[model samples]
Target: MVYKELTGTSVRLPANFTGKRFLTIIALNHAMESSKPVCSDGITRDISAALIRNVTLEHAAWTETVICQKGLPYLLQSNLQKVPLYNSTTCLSKCNLIAETTLADYFPATHISGSKDHDISDFICQFLPLYTNETLVYLPNDHIVLNWEVEESGSQVDDFYVGLGLDATEKDSPSLVDYISTDRKPYFKHRHEAIGSNELFYIFIKTVNKAGLSNIAILGPFLIDQTPPQYKYIPRVKISEESILFAWESDTFYDDEQTAEINQLAFQFGRLSCV
Candidate 1:
């Protein structure tokens, strides 16, 4: 699949996810209740959060020491004097060896994301994600605005596409999925998922700067409608931005297993979005 620019010509930077740290990997495992400790980077190892943090802290100190040694060469003057007989190339090689050794110990504990020999895990990194909150507001002029709260992740969120269909099976393709708008903004006003209740609807999202429709996320199998049954227009709250004031809520967020299932179904319609 080819990436068709739906917003504009310029490239938008992806959202930076907090899960970049080792702590996030631990959190993800805990959240998913997985026995195997692994990160999206494909590094699988049984490790504790405390150990990881300690290793990270140690690595930081060691790095600082290395920087200090580089800035103040005098710190190694005594050693250099003893090794005066050694050539400059030998000295440089020894320094490089020390750095490699020091890094080898602590790097594994922190940089467990992936290795050149290993492939990245999609389930932990790409598949398992947190859901963001959305707010619905009704203007006095009958204008409806959906404030979609984009959640933070280890990946970048490019754009979101809100689509309405008869069922999950309907409009399975990104091209077929009813898209209203595309942007980096968390809020969508012109078109949203809350359109009709007679059919199922969904939200399709894109993450990363990959080509085609491979990295797009499919969220939802909702029954959203503009005017809910006997729905009286409620005044918008001016307090917190957490509350959603939409006509009705969208049911795109699902359980882990169910979400995987829904996502699989959505991927089946990939042909529509892929070139």
Candidate 2:
């Protein structure tokens, strides 16, 4: 007797997540831990906070010294008759090599190389950086009044943008549109836009400098609607002094490993605002 097989629906299995080897990018929770150390630049390892006070707090600037006062001692100590004190400026002061160097034998000192403390800086030279702060300075109302601050400022800033965010998946192909700027500051699409707007839009921003567009600074995907709840006009909003407000016994901020599948289920009704 030949047995005829009857066709039936086979059970479908979930995706094989078990025992699968996959790559994961691990990052430290900066909020809970300290970060790494920093290095310093050479030549002028002796920096004073007074110097920063002297520098302008505007746009980032760089300065290079053709000749320097401090280099004479280093050169004279190194026993080089005529050495160069090449001092260059950069945004940061955490690098190798000396920035300030002296010109060889170009000393204006009439008498063969004068004394050490003979106003070395006066006979030599000095160069330092000056930066001015670039800001999204805004003025809300027009009293036709002037802002005493930034009255004598000079700037060459082109433009700026601000928005919500993008997912890590579509970092390459993003929908960059609906951008707006009025007086250099951006008033683009945020999560707090018209009702029903998505709370996720990439905040890609860049500035067109003298060297073309600078690197796109993706600040954050701020859920702008992350604001706490607000109260509206409720005239009879009376509350008894003997009212008791209750809450759950759990914290919200969690790591992916700790707040896995089963853990998320615990927050089904956890609409908390306070920490």
Number of the predicted model whose TM-score against the real structure is largest: 1
Query: What C-alpha lDDT do the candidate models reach, one value each?
Result: 0.28, 0.27
Would you give me the overall lDDT of model 1? Answer: 0.28
- The regions of model 2 sitting more than 4 angstroms off are 1-155, 163-165, 168-178, 186-199, 224-248, 251-275
> What would the TM-score be for candidate 1 when compared with the true structure?
0.24
- Off-target runs (Cα >4 Å) in candidate 1 are 1-145, 149-154, 170-177, 191-197, 208-220, 224-275
Candidate with maximal lDDT: 1
- Kindly list the per-residue Cα lDDT of model 1 for residues 35-82, writing each as its tens digit: 454334432221112110011111011001110122111111101110
| Model 2 local distance difference test score | 0.27
